[model samples]
Target: MQKLFKSSHNAAGALLVALGLCQATPVIASETWHWHGFVAQGLMRSADSNFVNNDGAISAELTEFGLNSTWKLSNTVRLAGQLMYLDGGNRFQQGGRIDYLFLNWTAINDMDWQLDLYAGRYKNNHWLYSATRDVAITRPLIVLPQSVYFDAFRDIAVGSDGLAVTSTHNLNFGELELNWSLGATPIPKEQSQRVISTFINGKTEQDFVHQFSVFLRPAQSKSQWGISLLDSDFNYRRVANDIFADGDFTVQRVMANWRYSEQDWELSSEVFQERVSVYGFYAPGTERTQFGWGAYLLGSYNLSAQSTLYLSHDHFFANKDDKRGYLLPQQSGGLIPAYFGYQRDTALGLSHNIQPNLRLKMEYHWNTGTGRLGPNVVPDTVVNRSRHHELWAVQLMYWF
Candidate 1:
């Protein structure tokens, strides 16, 4: 199945490239084609923590360069894709990747409603920022709230390789939008180790991820409300001499979000509860199920035409039943620390536009607990020993 998906993706990319080449002809050159790109570099530091680097030194690992293009094949069809190279230190895998490459088709269009279909690697639009997180200037903060946008799972959560559909309906009272996606992301060995454990010596595969979401905007109102649902499955295959056994995981999530905007200020929040079931992995026949929850509230104000300020609070717990993590150490036979069970953060950020196409951003975070850090399957006790830590970053971005 993975091989088939890869082949299809390659074919779609080739077709898009061919179409782009054909558009070079004067007859077709008139067709709509747009290109955009960006370059961003930043400095980050994590004090009393290994979130950025184990040595706890200021790092210049934050780097991003992306190029994207959209070509209109016809009035009802278009091809869009973005290629990016990123090195975010411990945040995610470092390398070049296709952020999204897909063919979008307008399936139905009318005065009151419209439907669109997508095939190939589609971008995730279920979350408020999921669709634009790849662009540095589009994000509100240098580092987003980890409770929901955990950087370790960036690639897998950004999108999937398969199909998606979106529809918008105009009603007497408001406008409603619905979205659904079914797909899977190929996991590399390095990413698997980051998500599971560095000790893992096996291949991790995402079987599928099914998601649905709905959004509503009432007439004459500046507020938007939304709800999203997600279900995913994963499997791990161990090789010879591996310490852990083959494993299977099932994850389900329900999320609710709201956003309100005024001329100068904006507020948004999202809360979610998730259930995770694990089988084997640690040892043969080992099984467990845990419920986790996360939430974040953010507010931003436009200080001026070229400046903005942001504030937010974020929280996450590995087990809702043990928010304080008092039982975590006990459950792990004293090997895991209590701090591994939860994480809470308060952040402040500011962004100034140096020019229409250039921007500078800075942010500071006061964090408690280490639940959101990496090597989650097995806590990295040595580096993440502190329950309290701080993180700060400054970035400069340019785009055209």
Candidate 2:
């Protein structure tokens, strides 16, 4: 029965991919309106139990479909939005949801200088790949580096509702760009499970979550360097008075990125430090702070105009001070193991452009440690005890 289920799921995924390819339409324009979209399907399996749904079996829950459009109301102002559907197992909510909706204004545009403003739900372009990562073809791997681009925070981290500004300067040497956003968005129940109710069964509701991000990129020759800061405030409320208490969460993150691309070779690296503060959550009048850090280096080479190979090493620690999870057992009275405090991942990926509108990627990941595992998917810590795991995935994406 299990084998039959897996085969059926893979077949459905393949059918979806084929339908997407056959039906994909190019960016259509009618005078001032322009539109485009993409669809992707992925089949994944883990050698050992992991956090994503039904870990030991081949699963096709990794799916993405989106439609985006823009209306150029004027030369300087435009309306833009997207409707997206994603089913990433425990990573995201099932079914469809509006990804982003916004109006863009070109406040200033001149030779070597540009300024833009946006109001509404806008994509988070601060991270190296946050803005386009939802589209499989635009991403470097089926799953992004888990340390910086965690799956649990996908919806909240992808975009926010409010206001943003962007500016660019074309310098004699190269270019410089600066962007910042401030807004609020609701946090889904699944996202709150990771932090709010670690061991208990509960649902979480957030009236609103405030988020802010700022990014600066300076480019010279064939290399570009970026610095970004992301911060958020969460006001959480437990539903039905579950074993969890209502509280506030504040998260601050700082990251640095550098990339060099020339001809058929590209090298990219990013390092980040994060600080999380919890108030009145664990106990009344109690405040705790945790510091974590992670980094990744990726190198890619184009074998031909239609194929590419990539290799990356990603490492992260829940607590930088305790890289080995020394105090976890003591703190939890041996209920939780120390290996749950960090994760080390190494990945090899290959992608081929079968056609201008079709692309495929095959990738493998070797992971050590389970610190970054999502509790919502693999709620039982015992299932993650192996500390060493492997994942193999293939994704097909079609877009115009």
Candidate 3:
């Protein structure tokens, strides 16, 4: 069943690639077609933890390659797509995947307002950096703050397959933008093991994800503020002699974000509250629900025309009521450590433009707690034995 599911998607991806290439030959000299791609490689290491490798060895797992194109079918319609290959070690699944392939229609355009609609596999534009997260050069750091952009949920949160709509209004006080999306993503076998548990032999499927967001740019200001809401559902079916039973899960979230920019510096922040409910996963007829909250603040300054420095502080808690994590060990009969209930980190980074189309980036992190690690549902205490850890990474990237 899993093989069939994967092969079908792979076949679709191959078809899209073929169409793009075959059509490009005929329209190569036309202004209506455009394409771009990027490649990046990095070395990363984690100390006193298994974040990158079990033995704390230097690893070359941070790799990304992508190609994307846009072809204008008509004045009001266009076709856009991206294909990517990624290997981020323990962060998420590895190999090739279709990031997004969609038809965009400019439904309305006027002096006062504009509207756009997307169908097929559409990108998630609700989050602050979600739309550009796949491109290494567009990100602020080698690793984003895990409190909000948890790596474990990268594939599931990146995008969805369905429909989306966006509308923008130029108002008297400011500009307002509204977005809505409804869709779901397929969860592959490797992702299931990384997100749920390594011991389980089962299939996990995302039922649906519904999201909405609104942003306001106050008149004559260099800042923007936005708010978003999301609701998603998932189900799991166990195979023979599996460690876990059939289960259902639901997640709901509300987030507020703000960004400010100046000639030489920038500031951004986001805070969110999430609620998760689980049924029949750990045991039959068992149910549990928890509310968690997280936030991050980031600031960057231009050191020179070709270099920049940045810093960030991030925090997350599994249960808002138990911020210190004392209750976690007690509830698990001391089998789970307190650190597993929360995670906090401070990061410092630097980026330098080696040339117009090439860049180098380096970053270091001081971290506490293992709450953000995966197989998140089960908590791998045996491998992530330490509560305090340090990580550093360096990468070089090129684009065309």
Q: How accurate is candidate 1 locally (lDDT)?
A: 0.88
Q: Which runs of model 3 end up more than 4 angstroms from their true locations?
A: 1-8, 19-29
Candidate 3 residue pairs in backbone clash: none
Q: Report the lDDT tens digits of candidate 3 across residue range 270-341.
A: 999999899998989999999999999999999999999999999999889888789988988998898988
Off by over 4 Å in 2: 1-27, 194-220, 376-380
lDDT minimum window of 10 residues, candidate 3: 20-29
lDDT of 3: 0.87
Residue-pair clashes per prediction, in order, are 0, 0, 0
After superposition on all CA atoms, what RMSD does each candidate show versus the true structure? 3.2, 7.8, 3.1
Arrange candidates, best lDDT first. 1, 3, 2
Task: List the candidates ranked by TM-score, beginning with the highest.
Answer: 3, 1, 2
TM-score per candidate: 0.95, 0.88, 0.95
Stretches > 4 Å off in candidate 1:
1-30
Model 2 per-residue lDDT tens digits across residues 78-184: 87766678887756668766566678999999998999998877778787888877667778888888898888777777777777888888876567788887776
Model 2: residue 216 alpha-carbon error in angstroms? 6.4
Residue 119 in candidate 1, Cα distance off native in Å: 0.4
